[model samples]
Target: MIEKLAINGGKPVRDTYLAYGKQYIDDDDIKAVVDVLKGDYLTTGPKVKEFEDTVANYVGAKYAVAVSNGTAALHTACLAAGIGEGDEVIVPPITFAASSNCILYCGGKPVFVDINPDTYNIDVEKIEGAITVRTKAIIPVDFAGQSVDMDLICKIADKYNLTIIEDAAHALGSEYKGEKIGSIADMTEFSFHPVKPITTGEGGVIVTNNEELYKKMLLFRSHGITRDSKLLTHNEGPWYYEQLHLGYNYRITDIQCSLGLSQINKIDEFVKNRREIVNRYNEAFKDIEEIITPREDEFSNSGWHIYVIKLNLDKLTCTRKEIFEALQVENIGVNVHYLPVYLHPYYEKLGYKRGLCPEAEKLYERMLTLPLFPKMTDKDVEDVIRAVKKVVDYYSMENCPL
Candidate 1:
């Protein structure tokens, strides 16, 4: 089952399946999960604390709250940051839907901003113009692991008394302006989806320096029920509890925490391997005028969660669709990072037209995400490169320089 393609009628192609992203789980990770399975607490327990502490310490955040997934983390983050009804949260339309959806979950409206072409991130300069009396927060996504222009973003936030919630789902190990990203924002959310830099089988976390926000998120993550008697007006029993606020059961299991701990132990190695793959990709496509590779910010560091390349259609004989199909036929897995949030039929009805964000729209039309993960081998890299070159060559026959 593993050797055959799940699509295209299941024909055998290679010895193994090459996914766009995958986890590099070693024996230690397996053992950790197994140990949790054998332990008393399979849900929230000591391992969660250890995992949270590890993340907090690593990212220099004062506290971290593990949640069910990134969306839950975002929801809790918005709630913790005091985003409420009548509040307007400025968010980039280029991000995943959850980034904007979180604002709505907090009973706030989402004000969409356009993105910068080269970075594929929210345009910080364009952000200030969208602010209004109700504007309360700014959620800047670290698109594809590259840190956003935080210095300018923070500057704007300071200028407007706006709260900052970094959608760092793609940037766990990324840094900005010499400081780690999680520590920079008022609240930061991270994801551990299978395709992300790490895996916890759908886990997420909220990291912050504010104690009030941390406590609020903690309560929000666990059904808003509290066992501490101090918060209760009167203690009928020693087991008295309090419901301070409306919340959800967005708690993570100890099994996931156990896996996260193991994964964290090898994060450095995973990042190193990914960097090696990125270097290879950069070199392989360096001279190819048909694509534009991702660029790095001089003042920031990245985790490179995805390796997206923008197509240069002017020099190509094939359309984006044709090249994509050709690559699929050649057994290369391909994906588009996103369709602009505003282009979705739901948003279109909300008056978000095609030309609103020219830069993001143009980039969206041509971008393709190739296979990238720590598990990719030299042969896998070579195969992807060869497949891409073949597709480009086959489609651009007469237009080919040779």
Candidate 2:
């Protein structure tokens, strides 16, 4: 039954290796960085404000605060939201470590919730059960660029007086219902890593409608120092500033902002192209019995960050690790999205144990992220599909024994 396997020496799908996700930097992106290099005030400058305003306008938010990276943005947002020691923030287990790490950064605890098996997002129903007298906020991640049910999340937040910080690192161009993601939550954080919808090398930003939170985030991004006269404690001279609160040096550079501005101009095209790729992948994999394509929530128009598939291990004769190795042998660089955050050693040390979120643990074992980036050509998409089919066919129970 295992005769069809690639390990027995069948030809691989492609001649070269393909990474799971990649950045697409055009000539314009390079020129934008070059222009920033020639300009004065590389950090804390006009370019940064321009990029912030552009994103603010795009996402329909009143204010946007640029920061060093996605994790920094999360931390600053938590700080602005008044999270502190003994506070508890509700988070989904099926997300990047930073989503929960930011809570710890503020001396707060993370109360993990499981995910909806179909959407792979935080289950709103489970959230209310986890809320306690110390509950402070909810950080629902838009995992894989699809927005969670914002209306329901907002309703829950309002009922409990909890702040909402949507972790939109994977969901820049995504929409919840007809509204853009950034404007719905109290504060939304976005990442500009190479693998994101846009590329700025490495950068992140937080957008909000609250003026008080906006100003606080600005102070937190740059060592908590404020040079404005209105915010100062005294009428000290030109170079005088006040340390308003304890904050971090999480400022983003003008070089990164300039590149981000250029990338923002092409966001529509980028999102459209990514959707096209996702559609093709879904169509190709639907008929295969060994896989389950990711399901997009009906209320969302996803930005399509990573194209993840769930292997139907019940129908497969080989293990997930075996299939992963088979894909690598075919030069298809597949990867796993996450292991439940609590399962990480650091969280275990914090007293979080396994079986806390059963669905997340189950999802982690079966999920596989494939190559899906805006710059991938049609041939690249086809090559990935072909490789997946080859691996699945070889491991099918009909061809192999369990």
Candidate 3:
């Protein structure tokens, strides 16, 4: 007989709740932050440059610009790319709203693209069809830590003379065709939020190989005010600066960078642990007819930020919400990654309507993220698996309640 689910008052598989994603902070990380707090600089200091250089070296990029948050990083990238009114940027709807919101921030229209149902990244085949004379760029997001089809995306961008601003917030440690995600795109953005692969409390960075773009991002990160002697048009003396362009105060703090420096040192290990957890989840759910595990392309090694499972609603009597709540009852902190960006009320009022991307809306209805983090132990992984299986089995169509 199948075990009763916790939603129906059965014993929970876990006594404590497990979060979907969390940062693994150690003593070293704390020490680093504290050291920065006691240092000579706090905001625009040597530590900021040090962190940028470290990220650049790690991702094999020519330069990196640390910013206050992921959204700021995206906005800075848009500014550097010269996205403006009447310009169109192609983006997938399945990602976080910030991915497309950055375009709107720059007075550009974000053209929503559907995702490949399997990989859940923007569909390469349909990208070209979205291109128009007004199209200036494509912001392909590396969803759920899996790198988007960069090779195909590059080809499309080259053919259309469009810039590629890859949103790699979930893919800092991920790899595509042996190259790191940051080094592949024209400008790649990374987030250092607490739940990300690495944590800086709240921080972000943009890395690029083009020096021109790099300098542009640097100015954009610092209120467009540059004291650089080379860039200033007129220098009164040694204490002169210029605000050449309109920019925001997107600068990141040295304290955050200090934490980031420590966190990045363990990124490989964190990624390894996440992948191992994903492997376990995949193995346990492979034979369950009510579930469809995430798929990774053979050419990619995902950083596995969050493990999401798609429910086979056809085989289950319960809705995704029912299953989500059921898992929560079993102490699993299951959550939805996103609703389609354009489906949000803000975007809806902006003239975007439903049925914009059929595939994304469908996937959003069926998908939910599972707990996958470096700190989760073997027992925690098993608890998640057991609770999921219990909930799914109880809700299976064959076991429909009277």
Best by TM-score: 3
- Which regions of candidate 3 fall more than 4 Å away from where they truly are? none
Provide TM-scores for the models: 0.94, 0.98, 0.99
C-alpha lDDT values of all predictions? 0.85, 0.93, 0.93
Which residue pairs show collisions in model 2? Answer: 1-399
Global lDDT of model 3:
0.93
lDDT of 2 by residue, 145-233 (tens): 99999999999999999999999999999888877789989999999999999978899999999999999999999989999999998
Q: Candidate 2, which ten residues in sequence have the lowest lDDT sum?
A: 1-10
Q: lDDT order of candidates, best first?
A: 2, 3, 1
Off by over 4 Å in 2: 1-5
Question: Residues 1-402, candidate 1, lDDT per residue (tens digit)?
Answer: 122222334442344546778777889999999999999999978999999999999899999999999999999999888898889999887778899888878788888888888889898889989999899999999998899988898899999998999999998887887777799889999999988878899999999999989988899998898887767777799767888888899999999999999998877777788888988999998887787888887876788899899898887876788777656766778888888887888778866688877888888889999999988988999988877766565445444543
What would the TM-score be for candidate 1 when compared with the true structure?
Answer: 0.94
Root-mean-square deviation (CA) per prediction: 4.0, 1.3, 0.8
Candidate 1 to native Cα RMSD, angstroms: 4.0
